[model samples]
Target: MKKMEDNTLVFIVDVKVNKHQIKQAVKKLYDIGVTKVNNLIRTDGEQKGYVQLTMMLWMLPMKLGSSKLSPIG
Candidate 1:
């Protein structure tokens, strides 16, 4: 994970996940507003998604340490 700016967060997710799907998932799961989603393909064949949230202060007190896959709209 990377912190690009005050309001942006970077995540490495499954390549099959799309930008819109990511935006929805982040919004629903975190209860935070997402302004945008950008994708970056790495040389080693990994997908990086940089999410622009409305505010970084809305992050939960606990860290998102696990990559659990659940049903997300």
Candidate 2:
């Protein structure tokens, strides 16, 4: 399974993964609603793209489980 840090709405994702796919993935994985998703493609970089999501729709249990994620430096 993929691990994500708390306080982060952005994720480095696959080049082929589109907005719809990402939305579906997040929903399926977290079982929460998504308001919007912003994607930025970066070429010739170690990471392909950055995906931003809103935290407006979140599940209490899911958020609780994510507490272990350390803050990004």
Candidate 3:
């Protein structure tokens, strides 16, 4: 977690989503004003050999207001 100028803490989160949903997820983040996405990796799922996306995301502080947000639109 990194501290911001406002003395609030931010967390770096690793998320995995179905490959087909990557675009939607990233777009949703952008809409919420979060653009600090880190390393993005693609891998195969263990069970059905489906493509999966692993990306590093930034978690904003609670003071930002929208806590329960969904990246899928």
Taking every candidate in turn, the Cα RMSD to the unseen true structure, in Å, is 7.2, 5.1, 10.6
lDDT of 1 by residue, 1-73 (tens): 4464456767787888999988998888777788899998889889988888776533433334444522221
Poorly placed runs, candidate 2 (over 4 Å)? 1-8, 45-66
For all candidates, what are the clash counts?
Answer: 0, 0, 0
What lDDT tens digits, residue by residue, belong to model 2 across residues 1-73?
Answer: 1213432256678777888887788778766656656677776652332333355323334565764544344
**lDDT score of residue 4 within candidate 3:** 36
Model 3 per-residue lDDT tens digits across residues 11-69: 22244544335435544654333333333333642222111223232343243356664
Q: How accurate is candidate 2 locally (lDDT)?
A: 0.55
Candidate lDDT (C-alpha), each: 0.72, 0.55, 0.34
Q: Number of the top candidate by TM-score?
A: 1
Order the candidate numbers by TM-score, best to worst.
1, 2, 3
